[model samples]
Target: MPISRFPFFSSKRRSSEAFSLLRRFGPSKRIQSCNYGKSSRNGNGKPESNPLVNVDIQAPRSWGTYVIPGALLGFVGLAAIFHYNDERRAIPKGQGNKSSGNFVKGPIIGGPFTLIDTENQTITERNLRGKWVLLYFGYTSSPDVGPEQVQVMAKAIDKLEAKHTIKVLPVFVTIDPQRDTPSQLRAYLKEFDPRITGLTGPVSAVRQMAQEHRIYFKKVEEEGDDYLVESSHNMYLLNPNMEIVRCFGVEYNEDELADAVLKELKRTQN
Candidate 1:
């Protein structure tokens, strides 16, 4: 324990030297340089490198961004408009005439034809003048659908006569004249309303009449002696002059048929 003469050997001097060495070897210089660069880069409040840190980057937009969305919107708008038009066209003209404007005009649907009545007398379209005619094409041998439709037609005609003093002759023309002769027609018609008139003739004449009205019918042979008439279920409302006014499908009921007939009657009168 000798007392040191050099100041470097003193306790205070030794502590100051240790502090300088630590500062030289520590992260002070690196921290100072980083702060200086950051402040310089941010002097204009703008970034030198990428502004977003640890964030994904994307390229600039092209024309497809706008075009694609616009095209999709246009397609959707067109589809919606077409669907609206279809719905409008589905409505019948008897309900309203608003959508009737889009209906395409076609050829006249009825013409003159000579047929044999149930009384075995030859009848022509000319004989039914000045009378509204409800014409239906079906066979007497029709099992279910034809009979049901004929019943509906008879009921409608009766209702129309009772309500408006309007008389409509309901005519049943057979598509199967081979099986439904004049006597058979008379017997079959008696089962329904008496106002219904049954008519049957040669197969060629029946087929020509069906063609004029755009009706379809064919005979399908089943088991021995069992035959079926495959035909469309169509009913026609003809004016006094033998021109078709309106056509009905299988879905029409008695009330609907009568209402349609009345509307047409009023329209023709005006």
Candidate 2:
């Protein structure tokens, strides 16, 4: 064939070349991109090393996954803190109230009964109504435990009345009722406080009262065919309603006893 006059490509040939280049590197072709020289996954499920092209990648965000659980945990923690505070606030500030139910409130078997006091005045359950009573049960021959407890009661009563302007009737009931006649009890009580009252009755009656209170006692035999009674030394604090409010040791400190009695008084008043 003879040589053509024009050496440059024809328009159709130029258009074909342009089309081929676009097919190799056009917007429709898959592009790979990465950041900071770290490879990222591309849409083709392959690691990409290029940095200039746009890529679809995701990072963990806190809002959608963690926000709700964190909020719930915070709410639970705050509720527990508030509940503990409320329980601490509910503790008794003074003498506490008796538990409601099968528990006895006063001397278990106390009822209308006559007993000679320190001054030989007749006292009965009815006479004690509407007055706070501190009842002590023990024998005159009791070791230091009994007598010392009575002294504590006297002092505690005095302290409470002095500070809080409250009066408490302290009564000593004999556990060895058979041997502790009215006269013997009266004489023994004088060693404590003149305000301390003494009570004596038949053994059966005394046992009734002790049983009602669930107090334990027994008569131990001695050499003289006589017996010494070992019994509970509980000092019971009673409300004006004749209900047992607190049972404390005879040796309770004045502050502790006074606080307990005062708390009960507040409860009854309410």
Candidate 3:
């Protein structure tokens, strides 16, 4: 048939035909085998020369660069809010304190108190209604601060009475009641304005009254005959309802006190 059925072909002729086939296709088969071996050794069955296999890796970015500035900004915002609130609390309630004409609600001050006046007449908080009251706490033995404060009150009262029909009762309460009896207070008050009223009572009653009005007072012991009353210099302006309208510090002078009283009167009228 073709090549006489092959079983009868000579051995030398078979060898020669196999050699010719190898020369034509042996290189392609050997290359495929080598590629398969390389893929198995790399573990993913991918070629070593693949571009995706040797990709360059980069490090992850840190969060501190963004986080620190955000925290600082938050802290600054909180401080600004607190400062705004503190400034608002410092604003006064009536006119003459500022020209803006804005009224801020002040703190609620003053409380109930009962004591005896210069005439030995019992005076309670209720008796002081329907009239504005200027209240101060001091002793007759005060060296310098007490007299100056009383003068300020007297001048303010004279100015108010001369200008307006308002009735203001300037009341002085003694912190040292041990030596300030009714007669003693009357004589001490005579040195100041005639419109001023002096009040004194038992030690317990005076202490209670001072506590109610937030007046700080303490007895200072001296080695010799010298004695002093350590206390805060405070003056309170009370409305007709016996409620504290404003508190004047030691910094205010006679003119400033008068101006503040006038502004308060005008504010009440409005």
TM-score for each model: 0.61, 0.57, 0.61
Relative to the true structure, candidate 3 reaches a TM of 0.61
Question: Highest lDDT among the candidates is held by which one?
Answer: 1
- Candidate 3 wrongly placed segments (more than 4 Å): 1-107
Those runs of model 1 whose alpha carbons end farther than 4 Å from true positions after fitting are: 1-107
lDDT of 1 by residue, 83-188 (tens): 9876553423222222221121222565679999999999999888788999899998899989998999999998998988889999999999999999998888
Best-to-worst lDDT order:
1, 3, 2
Worst 10 residues of 2 by lDDT: 93-102
| Overall lDDT per candidate, in order of appearance | 0.76, 0.70, 0.74
What tens-digit string does per-residue lDDT give for candidate 3 at 131-178? 889888989888999888898998888888887756789999999988
Give the deviation of candidate 1 from the true structure as CA RMSD: 16.1
lDDT of 2 by residue, 1-270 (tens): 234423323534554565456546555535443332213447764556454554333443659578899899999999999998655533222223333212244444344556666566777788899989998888898867777788888888988889889999998988887778878887888887778888888777777776665567788888997677777677777777787767775446667777777877787789
